[model samples]
Target chain A: MTRARPLITDLLGGLVVTAIGVAGFVESWRMPRFAERHADPFTVPGLTPGLLCAVLTVLGVALILRAMAGRGGAVAIPILEWPAGSAQRMIFTIASVFLYGFVLFGNVPFLIATGAFIFIFTIGAELLNADRELGLLPLGVGALVLAIVAAFAIRFIFVSVFLVRLPG
Target chain B: MDGFFQFLHAVVAIGLSADLFVVVWATLLGIVIGMIPGLTATLGVALVTTLTFTMEQNTAILVLICVYIGAIYGGGRTAILLNIPGTPANAASALDGFPLAKQGRAGEAMAVATTGSFLGSIVGMLGLAIIAPWLAEFALDFTSFEFFWLAVFGIVLCGQLTAMDDPLKGWIAGFFGLLVAMVGQESLHAYARFSYGISDLEGGFGLLPVLVGAFGCAEVFVVMRQEATHLVASKVGNVLGSALSSFRYAKTWLRSGAIGTFMGVVPGVGEDMGAWVSYAAAKRASKNPEEYGKGSTEGLLAAETGNNAAVPGALIPVLTLAIPGSAPAAVLLAAMIIHGLRPGPLIMITQADFFYSVVAMVFWASCAMLVLGLLLTRPLLYVLKVRREWLMGAIFVLCVVGSYAIAGRIFDVWVMIAFGLIGFLMRETGFPVAPMILGVVLGPILDNNLRRSLSISQGDPLQFVSRPISMVIAALVLAIILFSLPPVQRALGLVLSRLPSLSRKNGDA
Candidate 1:
């Protein structure tokens, strides 16, 4: 038999979807109406979205019920389990992305930021995964060289060949 | 006859010029892009679209088409070498291709894949060349009601076909995507929608950012979750000899090509479905069915042919009806619109030679893939050895650059990140993303046609089902839903088994 998805995940996901859907419904209703413009009744801007929100809400409720049923129908309790090792990797990836996209690119010289990010990211990932036998210093040096070359190559391709304007 | 001669003349002109270099270069670039695990044919075309913005419209489109075709074909190499499909379309290929690689026949598998791709492309090109004009002419009769039905049918069929395991979830994802498309000022009213007073939301989520986010960043996160990746060395031997042996499966090649082309003509079904359905069909018909999952050459050929054929198959609807048959085709449609070539029923009348030009482009791309696939086998195998961590970091940078380059909107970058997270979550769950993409592309058409159909009938919704074409489409949709029901399926199976003729056919088979 297939393993059921944890109850907490589904229940929480359902609640979140339900909240969004209800909010969307309210907002769609609050939008300026076609009555002022004397437009066709069918031409209302909120028609599709209003309908979609209703559907989403219903689906959310169905999901909640399904999760309850999967938990043997009487339990309202939630289940939780943390994955091993993956949480760290996920956190690191998200943080690195936020730093690169939100904080780094426009704030500093493009090559410096990109090179540093790549070098550090590569070295960190290599150490964490530990698939290779190279010493840390040697790997770090190789990563830095690779990062420098990659940064320059990307700049030349995007800026010169493609004529794209890059953030400073 | 005159059109044919003109098309021939155009082909000859292009064949002789420096512009052919564009085809060669794009094909090579496409192969590299496709061989990368995170990058897809859609991304390759989208990235190239930006680079070709300043070129002539014809040349620009040619570059994109070549890249699209080459990328789809090129992904087979990674599937064979790494047991990881370089693109989602190559998933079926990995089933047989990787097993062959494990047996030291990786080069042979690559050769078969290339030959199949070339033949499949030829079949698809023929369909586009001969059928697109007629299909465009027929599409001229479509009204608001028919268009509305077509959009719904596209979304429903895509959801059902792509997410066969759980189509309801597929549909929810699709409708959610449609709602996402409704986030900006609408076309008819110019009224702000789900924007919530945010100026960036009013401008709307650009497709490029959403796509880059969904396919690229999301992929990085998935790879991050994996503990390790393994790469193996492949022996390159007798590529031509192995490729020639694929001729023994010519019937499977042709049948799979036809199946792929038909699937492509169904909007949003595209290469992945084509490859999977063909693979399934080949397995069903094979004499050595037990050999299928364990390294069957015929299985590899069918999948490769089906997907590569789907490239041109996907183009058929785009050229004829301004509707994309697949996600990559949606990007192609967008690129065409940016180049001031609006594809629709009147495209055949307005731009008579465009279809032929595309056919010629596909032909050259096939030739390029055949040459490059043979030549670049060893280098690609070497590339497969690159660690995912470094590559993932590099890919994220490209994603940022690609997202920001579209309209120079910082808001779009944020959208990319948000959607990337959403896409990752969706992947972790069983929800498919392809249908959502189709819905996003088809949302405007659905919205506009629904409103227009209603208006035409003076607020009566019944008119949607009243029109002839609309009725046919509605009936087809209803039929599919009905057949998919478990009780009905079981009943039909029993009835069919009881029928003497069907039973005899089954028994004979």
Candidate 2:
């Protein structure tokens, strides 16, 4: 029964997906009536629910079969398991990327933001590995150099040559 | 004869100008990008595509073609040296190439790969020149039913071929990709399907963001989790000596070239499939099949030759039929359209000199690949010594920049990050990423054509079966599905094995 829980979970997942797909078909069927009132007649005429319904039906049938065959459960198979603390590192990385996009883009400028992102990320990766012997100075310097070189080269090509406008 | 002279004249004209220098430089830049892990041939082409938008059509075409050739060949370098394939197309190469590197024959492996690539490109070009018209005629016969089946077949085949141990994961991954492709407005009409009231989703997911996120950012996250800081470095050796050894396995080169061209002609399948199929076939045919994954030069040669050949092979459909055989070919087709050139049946009649000029471009691109590959071998080898952490980090930044620069939208950057997470999760599970990429690239084609065909048929379900070409394609699709069944495959294999022997005996008698 303990081993069977995974199979049950997969079955439930498949069922949920099928239900969603069926709901989509139903929703699409109702959409034309609503769209007709709000939208132009030219647009609503082409947005037929038949095609959407057919696609959903097909997908639902496929999913049901896959679940019945015990195939849906197989997607959870792990090739390489992440180490403990890896989740934290991934979260931090994602946060850093978001910061680099939102906060860094406008304030720090492109080259500086790019350099900082590289430097911080490399250091963070090293710290996550928990390798103290390597030290931060060399890695930081190397990353800065690489980031500068890359940023300038990209600017030269994309901006100077191609004349694409980049965020300063 | 006059056309031939004009062809030669165009070739000479381009060859003498700064356009030739641009081609050379582009080829070198492409090689550098390709040799680095996470920078793929597709990305190289896509990035260069935007740059070439401002240039003259002929010069743009030449630069892009040279880059395409150089990048495809360049991926083999990292595969042989670092054991991490620079692109998915090089995955098969890494199987035997890395083993050869470990055996202190890294230089030899690189050389063999280079020679095989050169030979393979030439063979593919010849095929393009000689058989493109006939092939295009055949392709024109393909309609909506055929395209839908082709897209499905590509996804299924890629999944089955890539995932050696499990096919289920492949299908799931592929379906997931299809679902992702479905998020935007339907192609037949601008009706939103899964926009969820979000204005940004109106355009659907951008290809550049999805690609960068999947391959680039995901790779960085995966690498960051690993314990190793630096890639294991191998001693470099004589590249020329290894190239000479490639000639010893001439049969492998020829076989792979044929396989590559065949795979490339099939719409939606590309260099990755070419490499996989060629590698598999070479292994099966070789006396030393067991040595394939253990650094056999034959395996490396087959993989490299197949992928490089696929570069020119992909262009055949684009030049002749106006239909792209692969994703990069689709971009190339778009570029052609932008240049006021429509490639189809009438192209040869309408623009005979332009047709010859494309042929000339391919030839020059091949020559450029050979020269750049040999000259840059030593310096490029040093790149393999870079720490994995640094390399991965640098690539992540490039991915961000590349994704953001595509549309200059913050939404695209977020999309990249989101897809990167999804790609990472998918990798942790058993899903193959190639099918997903294929789905995204081919989704609109399948959707638009299927809807158009149905409209033409007035919603008649049997319309696909009624058309002769569509009927043939439907039968082929059915045949492929039936062939995948174990019992059917075994029976077919038994029959196939006996036929060759019977034919040989009959010939001898």
Top candidate on lDDT is 1
For each candidate in turn, give its C-alpha RMSD to the true structure in angstroms.
3.6, 4.9
Which structure among the candidates has the greatest TM-score? 1
The sequence of per-residue lDDT tens digits that candidate 2 reaches over residues A79-149 is 34455767767777778777886677546777788777777776776677654456668767766787778
Taking the tens digit of each residue's C-alpha lDDT, what string does model 1 give over B1-509?
87678668778877999878998899988888788776788878877777777789999988998889888988888898888888889999999999998998888999999999888888888778778888988889999888888888887788788778556556667777777887898988998798878999997788878877877788788778766656554577878889899989978999898888888889888998889988999999899989998999999999999998899999999999888898889889888988899899998888887777887888888888888888777776776667787788887888887788768777777888888888888766656777777877888888888887777798776787887888999998888767755569789999987799877889999
How far off is model 1, as Cα RMSD?
3.6
The per-prediction tally of clashing pairs is 0, 0
C-alpha lDDT of residue B281 in model 1: 92
Writing each residue's lDDT as its tens digit, candidate 1 over A80-114 gives: 32366576777888988888888888788889988
Worst 10 residues of 1 chain B by lDDT: B226-235
C-alpha positional error of residue B467 in candidate 1 after TM-score superposition, expressed in Å: 1.2
Off by over 4 Å in 2: A1-27, A33-80, A85-89, A106-108, A129-134, A145-149, B1-10, B140-190, B226-234, B320-324, B327-355, B485-509
Relative to the unseen true structure, what is the C-alpha lDDT of residue B255 in candidate 2, on a scale of 0 to 100?
91
Question: Which residue runs of candidate 1 sit more than 4 Å off their true CA positions?
Answer: A6-16, A71-85, B485-509
